[model samples]
Target: MDASTFFILVLIGSAAACLLGSLTGLGGGAVLTPLLVLVLGVDLRYAIGASLIAVIATSSGATATFAREGFTNIRVGVVLEVATVAGALLGAYIAGLVDKSTIAIVFSIALFWSAWATLRGAPPVVPTGESDALATRLRLASSHPTHGGSQPYGVVRVPSGLALMFGAGVLSALAGIGSGVIKVLAMDRVMRLPFKVSTTTSNFMIGVTAAASVGVYLHRGQIEPRICAPVVLGGLVGSMVGARLLPRLRTRWLRVIFAIVVIGAGVEMCRKAIVGGF
Candidate 1:
């Protein structure tokens, strides 16, 4: 395809992917990576590099909106970022050693797990009016604006959450995605934060995680400016729009969209892996 046609397709694809990504906290990389490799016939490593750019852009575009609306937990995001960043560096280092098909398989598995976790649905959490001592000491407890007014929430299982974040970062580097699904699982399921708070916080954290891995990709000569530029531009636009739509969406709808998008991408990756794309 010609340069202009490739750019247009990438722009459209990244925009759609980021729209759902910003809403579900998956980040655009999950979908965009597969689209680039499978549909656009880009090399896997190059797709990963471009996807990282999109993930960073999506985070930057959506995070400010979420923070302004009081959905993001900055305290939580900052704390977990330490582990994620560390893991991202390690994962990026390992990515150079692994073959492309292996990366594809691992990426698909992670996506399926993310889909199952969100689709299974968790019970509604009612605030117990008590906060964990560790969380309280760390000032992790916070509130978000709800239809009824401000609703307060508490944090729990800090150690477990941090461990999961580290894993999330590693997978993110391997998959060339933001690892937002695992981040959301850590905060929403393990940390016991509200769903919206978890998603927004995941958005805030993924950008930093992606940035860490991006350096490794850069040194390896995987990042193509031509591919990354349009993808980032489109992702920024889509993420901003998705961020605006999140406040009005119900939790159930978000979960449904998250599961659907993740599963579709996972299936596509699996197909490419079986076909030996590398």
Candidate 2:
């Protein structure tokens, strides 16, 4: 394809990816990387670099709105980011050593996991009405706006949540996705934060996590501005639109549809890994 045609197609595909990602709280990198690799025949490393850029863009755009609405808990997000940043740097180093097929296989596995989580739906947040000592020390406890007005929530299992955030960062760098699936799991399941807080806080941290590895990718010359430009632009626009539509839509239905798509993407990635050996 010519340069212009390739850019246009990438823009369109990235937009769709971001829209679905935002709606499902998954983030665009999950879909964008696969689309570039399987369809556009891009190198895996380059695709990852571009996807990270889109992740940062989508996260920044969506987080601004979510934060303003009081969905994001800034304190919790900041504390978790310390772990994620360290993990992201390590994951980026590992990515450079791994073969393309190995990355593809890992990416496929992550996709499957993400799909399963989406299908299962966000677990109910059962606040123990008691907070972890660590959480209290960090002041991670917070509240978010609900239909009933501001609802308070307590943070629990800070140590476990931080450990999971580390894993989420590793996955984010390894697969070139936001790894919001794992982030939400850590917050909602382990920390006992409300679902909305978990999702928004995940979004709040994604950009920083991706940014941590982005510098490494850039230094390695993986980021191609030509590809990244359209991906970022489209992702930002699409995610903003998706954020606006989030409150109106039934998330369960969106999750079902998005999960099906994620499963298909996973199958494709695995097929590629099998057919094209390391």
Candidate 3:
């Protein structure tokens, strides 16, 4: 395909992916990376670079709405970001040392893991109003607005949550994703935050995490403006729309869609790896 045609397709695909990513807190890169590599025939490194740009755009676009709505836990996001940033730097360095086939295999595995965890879903978390001592000292516990009123919640397992955020960052840089799936899991399941709070906080954190890792790709000469420009523009648009719709939207169906898309992409990527198409 010609450059213009490819650009148009990328624009459309990125818009759609970012829309879903905003709603699910998975970030645009989760879906955009696979689409670029598997459908558009972009190289893995270039695709990852573009996806990181998209993730940053998506987070910036969506986070404003989430933060305004009082769903994002700023303290939690900021605290977790330290570990995420550290891990992102290490992971970006490792990505340079690995071959395309190895990266592809690891990316596919991450996708599969994301799908499985999303599908299985977490059990309902009933806030017990018992905040961990560490969480209290760190000021991690906060409240989110709900239909009835402001509902107070407590944070738990601070150490475990930080550890998981570190892993999420490593995967995010390695796979060119926001690693929001793992971030949400750490906050919602391990940290015991409300689902809405976890997702919005994860969204708030994505841009910082992507920013930390993107420098590595830029220095490596993997980022192409021709590819990244349209992706960022499209993702910004989609994420804004999704953010506007989030307050009233029920996310049960969104989770299913996220899982299906992730699984399909993982399967296709696995096939490509097996066929030596990396």
Candidate 4:
């Protein structure tokens, strides 16, 4: 494709990915990377770099709304970010040594896993009754606004959650996706936070996680301004629109549709890897 055509397509594709991501609470990077590599014929590294930029843009944009709505648990996000940032730096270094095909295969596996998890639906948020002493001391336990008022929730298994967040960060740097799936799983399931709180907190942390590796990608010259500029702008705009529309949309249907898309992307990535096209 010509430069102008490629730019337009990237803009549109990134916007669509961000819209779907915002609606599904998945973040734009998950969809954007595969779309760029598989459909647009972009190099995996460049695609990942652009997707990371889009992830930071979309996450930062949505985080403002979530925070204002009292859905984000800032304290929890901040505490977990220490682990994530550390892991992200390490993962970025590892990415430099890993083969593109290996990265593609791992990314595809992660996509499939995410699809399966999403398809299974978000498990009911069950409070563990027991709270982490560290969480209590850090005041990570918090409340989020509900229709009636606000409901309080406790944080559990803090160490486990922190470990998982580290893994999430590793995946984020390696695949150039937000790895929100892992973040939400850690907070919502392992830590036993409210669903809304977990999702928003995951969104809150994603930008920082991406930013950590983004510097590495930039230094490596993988982040191209020509590609990242439109992707980031389009992703931000689309995520804003999606966030506005989220309350009115049927999220169950959105999850189903997006799950199919994720599965398709995973299959395509695997095919490319097998064909030596990674």
Q: In model 2, what are the clashing residue pairs, if there are any?
A: none
Whose lDDT is higher: candidate 2's or candidate 3's? 2
**Estimated TM-score per prediction?**
0.90, 0.96, 0.94, 0.96
lDDT of 3 by residue, 78-195 (tens): 9999999999999999999988888888888888887776667665877656798999998888888888999999999989999999998999999898888889889988899998
Candidates' C-alpha lDDT = 0.85, 0.88, 0.87, 0.88
Clashing pairs in 1: none
Tell how far residue 148 is off in model 3, in angstroms.
Answer: 2.8
Query: Cα deviation of 276 in candidate 2 (Å)?
Result: 1.7
Candidate 4 whole-model C-alpha lDDT, 0 to 1? 0.88
Give the true-structure RMSD of model 4. 1.2
Per-residue lDDT, model 2, residue 15, is 90
- Model 3, TM vs. native: 0.94
For model 4, the stretches where C-alpha displacement exceeds 4 angstroms are 128-130
Worst 10 residues of 3 by lDDT: 121-130
Off by over 4 Å in 2: none
User: Candidate 4 — worst ten consecutive residues by lDDT sum?
Assistant: 124-133
